[model samples]
Target: MGVKALLSKPLAAYVHKKDRSWIENPVEAQQAVFKSIVRKAQATRFGRDHGFSAISSHADFVQAVPVRDYEGLSSYFNRVKQGEKDVLWPGKPLYLAKTSGTTSGTKYIPITSDSISNHINGARNALLAYVHETGNSAFLDGKLIFLSGSPELEEIGGIKTGRLSGIANHHVPGYLRTNQLPSYQTNCIEDWETKLDQIIEETIDQNMTLISGIPPWVQMYFDKLMRQTGKPIKDIFPNFQLFVYGGVNFEPYRKKLFESIGKEVDSIELFPASEGFFAYQNQQQDKGLLLLLNDGIFYEFIPVEEYFKENPTRLTIGEVEPGVNYALVISSNAGLWSYSIGDTVKFTSIKPYKVVVSGRIKHFISAFGEHVIGEEVEKAMQRTMAKFPTVELIEFTVAPHVSQDKGASFHEWLVEFSREPQNLEAFTDELDQQLQKLNSYYYDLISGNILQRLKITGLPRGTFRDYMKSQGKLGGQNKVPRLSNDRKLADGLLGVAKL
Candidate 1:
């Protein structure tokens, strides 16, 4: 066997060994990670002020630190950006990973040496886990492409700053560069459309076997390739066997992506963000992702039902149970202390700590006490679309229409479709039925006549794309909001569609 194939054996062995240890005792592994972080950061400002040096157990740590969001931690981050050393983490950060800021203004997240190591190792172990399970050694012999943002980083506050994907690309091991596609020059193009064209030109004929990206952009790339070559994606890259994706749920985009691929391929979902690499799909047989318990991130969860209370109880790894939606909180080596990243998740397995993203804390629709979340809406959409095989959804967003012009408040969904449903009324009815079955609050509201039925506006093709472009968030980790508590985003989208 060649050297490349031989390399997989040792890597797979290492991953399996570590994974076994973690799975056998996830609670112990998390406690160990938490202790290590406290020891390392004990001298830092946050740790010292929070009494981390005196803390000896999880209960003490919990008592010392309170849950904080981005707004709460902004001051400390601002100090770090001003060249303050040992503020959040030890010494100054090596770089900052800038968030896409879809919900608010841009945020500069710290990327320290230790945190970056976790990111790199977590990603490597994820791939190793896949290989260990499937014994797919030939994957390494061919090219693997990561369709990501531009790699050209800019200087901010005397520190290098760029998108998380670009920062990750900068750390790609020298040995793996040979099998990676879209040469560094191509990855540096700033404009997404220009970069897509360049990427297609450079990789259309390459021996690509693995592709990693968000589902929507990858679909766009595949569509452009088919338009250019007059052939399906599998014909262009027959060796393509794995599709790695993150940043958004795969359910909404699965059918269209498979149709674009024209064949079945193994897929792995990841839960990565600017804050940290949180979880990854570890087993092919399991639907939920295995939470990375031993990573540098220390996790805390607040029950979503009580999240808005004056003081919500924070649950540690040992306290979390299956089937409950919780707002995830973390105290990472990157300097965040008990920070809520605004995402909600439901645990599926407690023994090994497997979870699935449920929704965002701020991105929910509770206009009339329905309290509908992204997970409910997504599943509803999936059921609705399953009945109309001819129609494919491109993008959609929902908001409350509170104006009394109709005498009752109703939810409005603006949808962009690749193919129109045969009967719009039937489609909307199916959507409403699925939602009623999924959410009891929404069902009660509709049945009791407190809220009118859901209404859908068929947006012209490319409405979401246009709105994102108009907002200067055209690509790379930017997505249109799926649900809004108010009508601002939905109305803006409608106004843009009219233009």
Candidate 2:
């Protein structure tokens, strides 16, 4: 066995032992997690007002706390942002993760020390899970390039404020730092195009063994490396073994990403938000990520079909069944209480509580009653790409085209392509066919003549990169919304294309 593998055996064994019962008794594991969080936050005002002192069961906690979106808790968050002490958590937050918002402009999410620990430990445990299952840790001996945001953070109300990835950059363990690249200077450049240029200059010849990032940004890096070296990613980093990705669904990018690498490599998917790192892929055979019951986040699920109704039912982990989509609600160490982070997920397994993210709650296309979701669009695009092997997608978004002067109202696609298709008309036809097969409502709309066939608007290359650059969201943990119901983001992309 390799020396790296031999050294990791004990740590891997410990992770397995700790996680065994979580898989064996998911309900109990989650209940323990809830109870711990309640006790931890019980002294806070939110807990007091919500009767956490008298809370003995999940039912009582539910009765005491009302379901809340970010807007519902904005008042408390305002206070926290103003440097109020013990407004939510027991102490002041260490940082505020600034995430993109629609009309609100930006959202400042509190990040406590405990929350940071949750993120760091969650990533470490995920790695340990990989080691335990695959019995391979040779990647540890070489550089693991994390395509993260700048390390330089801005101060807001005496707390550091930045993207989650940038905040995390400061906490990479010293031992791991020895094998991490690019240099601190390159990572802190602030401009993504410049940062990418610096990263290429610094690490192109390094002994890179693992890489992790949001898929699109990482793809950009891969493309740059390929052009610079005139080689596939595998040729440039011969020891590369793993790709860890999150922030968006990987299915649409999987084929292109592998093509860039020129070979299949082990990959681990993660589900993390600004609030907390929630879940990670734990086993190779399981397609869904294992819901992290013991992480500092207590989870609740509101059935998506009922979420908009009056007095909607909220289910705890024990009450949730497999195969139903639920809007995820979380109460975390970060001081968020009964907060809906806007993501929807479907449980694939209840025994281990594994789930796949279905889509975002706000990001769906129902302009014509088709109610198409991000997953459906992504699956359709994936199928379309499979049929057209030469087409390389850079980025895309779908929006409703409701203008009457446009002949017929339909879904409009704004796509930036790295490689042009052999036949664009054939590609559109295949995409439409795939959509009809995936969503019955969409199929009905097409067949019933209620909506026109989807329109494809090919965008020039670098369109998305330019748009993100303009928005100052050009790096790690930031992602373009894949599907929006209206034309707001679509118009923005069009403007950038014009530029």
Candidate 3:
């Protein structure tokens, strides 16, 4: 083993041992984090306004602060952007994570000095957790590629501003910097395709052992690699043993990724966002991600069914139950108070608080009250794929198709397949049946004849890629929405889908 790998083993074990302290005392750790952040921010403008000084408990917190999305918090964020100190957190934020918002045009999420560690350490410890468990630190010896946004930043009110991934690039540990690729200059290229091409050129012959990115984009890289070399990724990067990914669920892309790799390799799933680094897959055998409790954030969970209701109940760490879908809310040291990051999660285990990202609160098909979520659709697709081993999917999305002539409505699945099932109708039927089994509301709607059975529209290969390219979201944490309530994305997709 090289010096880095030799050092990493003991360090990973130490980190894992320290993490057990927080993981074993979930509620206590959360309570401590809640008190610390709230007390620290008590003198800030937002704290003063929200009665943070007088708050004593979770109930007091609920009374003092209301849940808000980025739009609702814009007034305070505006002040921060214009260089207002102590408006949200104490003094100025270290960085502003700029992201494209749906209803709101652009969003600037604060990242304070105290909170940046959550993002940085959360990713580091995920690897450590894997290393400690499996005694595999050999990847530390080879090149590790993080397919991310440009490391370049533009200043907003003197605070560094960029995409979260780009911002993270600035903080990679000095020890690992030597092993990280592609070159900083190549990473700074503005266009994703250009950057990807540069990345391939730079690292095609390197001793790459770890590759990290959102699944679809990583798939794109793998496809490009195979096209260029006419070989699977395993042959090109024989030492590559780890695939670290976040943003989107991996199952839909799992089969394709493994096929491209030519073999199975260990992988890590992370739940990271501009708001905070929330969770990571700690155990290779487990599907759920270990939620970070002692990080600089206090978490709340609102039952997703009641998310749109007035005065929705917000439950703390101690109150959340396993298997319940909840809209994740957080108050972090970054100055966000009861902020809804729009993600919905279901706890698979509460002992150590392991959760699976179920769906986005807004990313669901509820046009007919069926309320099918991203998780349901993905699971259904997974089941269908399992049933038909020959079937190979590139990407897919679900949208409601309401008949213009007052006929029955149905869920339309836009799918891009690399290898179509021998019986496409049978495949569609299996997918629909799996969805109905997972979602009772959808089952009821189908059974009541209010909605017809789901229909599958075969999209030509690269259709989704072309669509993302047109939208200028071709790579770097961008994901095609799995479900949409309306037909905007569906209509746009159908135009180029060639029927």
Candidate 4:
């Protein structure tokens, strides 16, 4: 948090020329570089058969750390692939992301080598405070695009590497990245359909300033880079600027990806995972917040009033401070120690702390703020099925309840039966008017219905996450909770299951 306090920040004059006295240096030198990344992510979360032990507040690190998913890193990633180091991390495991777990179907998450040099030092301190708050790194000189999940590297119980976007695109620094696309091929460990059709024809005509991933694969790589260049994404990148993106919650498809890139998209918000790259975005993009990448994630927020009291409340990275609303905890180096990557944040100001990504400590529906995650209801159901092409679909989910006669609470849309349109309640009322033209506070609280007010069900004969993958518990890390404000398992599977 420096660049001379963001060069007097108005987003640092809109994007460059920072030095606000290195963001008022000294929060004890940012906790001595977050206690040396919490003693190297607590030596990869107490590996070599559990060891390191140091506790302080935030309810004594959630009563000495106890909250892990990714099924406790797939039971210590099958003992770190037999080349064993006991469990968490000690010897190997440096970079490996290759994700796909909503039930560990395709895995590997590690991310060590000091969390890949803490994700390139948190992407060069969030691009030097986003070029000192948008003064302009030319919004990051063209050709950055990420939209990942198909780079290479494969393995977990077998242990391979590369894949956090091909090890950050084969270790970034090829003079900071840009040979248009195709180049991370250490024999390109192939997967996700062998380089997504030439990575969608090498990002169609190149030149893409900072666009990052996740939005139905960046609108299927911008609709196949706009029908193979018939053009109209501002003429294939008329100097496109910022557009980062996180796993979800893109404020209801931000006006359809800013009206399909016609303009205004200088975006941000990352909070990376696959075990690291902790938090980002604070170049005054949306007015400063979400900071702690603390030199490779050693953070630990946890507070939404002690997350339902099984005992919670843990704020580190120098005792948090701002407006509170926590829950993150990392420890990193791919060993995940004080682990609890569920997410749920909120902090607005405190010297250089800043933050506010509030949701998903377990995917959405915390009543109304409808995080509806899993990539914002997969971009509000692909912008409401791209305005219906015979309403074809093969899957869906979005439960959340509370309507005992409009006591108020919304979002229902269960779906799964493919085709539609025999006026099924006017095709479910134009898919709830395309999620209320993509959010007008969810279109005045679901048309004054006070949030989705029930009734969309469907699923004809399948879809309770395909019965949680016919009971294999749907693979590894397990998913299918794209927001469930209520509806207790879709009301006991509509009282009989079968659909």
Estimated TM-score for each candidate:
0.97, 0.95, 0.98, 0.31
Steric clash pairs (candidate 2): none
Q: Give candidate 4's TM-score.
A: 0.31
lDDT of 1 by residue, 224-276 (tens): 99999998899999989999998888888999889988999998888998899
Per-model C-alpha lDDT, please?
A: 0.87, 0.87, 0.93, 0.58
Model 3 TM-score (2 dp): 0.98
Q: How much lDDT does candidate 4 score? A: 0.58
Relative to the true structure, candidate 2 reaches a TM of 0.95
Task: Please tell me which predicted candidate would have the highest TM-score against the true structure.
Answer: 3
Steric clash pairs (candidate 3): none
lDDT head-to-head 1 vs 3, winner:
3
TM-score pick, better of 1 and 4: 1
How well does model 2 score by local distance difference test?
Answer: 0.87
Ranking by TM-score: 3, 1, 2, 4
lDDT of 4 by residue, 363-399 (tens): 5554665444444455556666666645655445677
Quote the positional error of residue 441 for candidate 2 in Å. Answer: 2.0
lDDT of 2 by residue, 1-499 (tens): 5555477779889978987877787777778878887888888877777778899887888788888887889988888888888878888999998878754568999999888898887888888899888988889888889998777888887888998888888888777888899988888887888889999988898988899999999999999999998999999999899999998999878878999999999999998888888889988888799888877788899998788876779888889989888999998888888888899999998877899999988899998888888888998999889888888887899999996654378999899887878888999888998999988999998888888889899999888888888888887778899899998889999998983
**RMSD (CA, Å), each prediction:** 1.4, 1.9, 1.0, 21.7
